[model samples]
Target: MKLSYMASLAALFIALPAAAQPSTRPMGPGPMPVFADFDGNGDGRITEQEFIDARSKRIAERASEGRAMRGLSQALDFKEIDTHGDGGLSREEFDANQMRHFQNRPMPPAR
Candidate 1:
């Protein structure tokens, strides 16, 4: 009975998706900055605070007529994006992150 249960568990594990594995496969070159001017510190990294400040400033600029985002929402969003836990992101980290976003994005019809 114990062996049968173990076999069922093994089969369940084998049926799981492969998405969790980290690939060593190279990602071609990587996306160049869509907006480099935002890196004001010039430290080859974008700190969490800098990212939040820059995003807020840009949103405020475009929203000259009125506010669009709440303070809490912005803070939470920044926290979510700052995944490295280093308080800042190296350029490679940022680029690879952007690539992850693209990879997860839904594909369009091939037409």
Candidate 2:
């Protein structure tokens, strides 16, 4: 019984290192930023200025991490996403725009 318990513990220890290691495989394109990401002031709306600032911040973060910022280089601006022409974006408009843009992009084949 002592030998069996020791073997079990040894197996667990061996497996732990592997389990703790993060996956090296690419996680594919990152999630599209939503209105919340652009709503820097948490005001539940994204003005054009807020959109540009937030996008720049996001780009800087991804660049610093050496991450490929795919699907983010869309030609979209705040006016494009502000479907209602209200001069600001609502969550619904943002989500709809994401669906139209991000969801339609063809993913690259897995290596």
Candidate 3:
């Protein structure tokens, strides 16, 4: 009985470190930003016009902050992101675009 207890304790010690190690894989994209933040009229959906207006606002804010605006000037290709073929985008479609964009983007080199 004493030998068995010692073996069990040894096994637990060996497993603990492995379990405690942080995961290396990237985590899934979390919930999208509040819809009202983008959905201008509180209509619960985002139209292409609203999206463009919001993007323009964001670019202007970045420019005011003296941040680089190189990529912000271009318009968002709403058709490419509107996966459901609807005239407007639901919150899910917006979030999916965010995830796809992040996954496909090239990572910056480590310092």
Which candidate tops lDDT?
Answer: 2
CA RMSD of each candidate after superposition: 16.3, 3.5, 9.1
Alpha carbon lDDT at 72, candidate 3: 30
Residue 33: error of model 3 in Å?
6.0
**Deviation in Å, model 1, residue 16 alpha carbon:** 60
Top TM-score: which candidate number? 2
Task: Give the TM-score of each candidate.
Answer: 0.42, 0.67, 0.56
lDDT of 3 by residue, 1-111 (tens): 999999999999999999999755433322334556678997888998998887677656655555443323232488877889898989898878766655655443343
Give per-residue CA lDDT, model 2, range 1-111, as digits (tens): 999999999999999999999765545666677777889899999888998898899788877666666666665788888889999888898888878887677685578
| Model 3: lDDT of residue 41 | 93
Candidate models: Cα lDDT each: 0.57, 0.81, 0.68
Error of 3 at 79 (Å): 0.9
Ranking by TM-score: 2, 3, 1
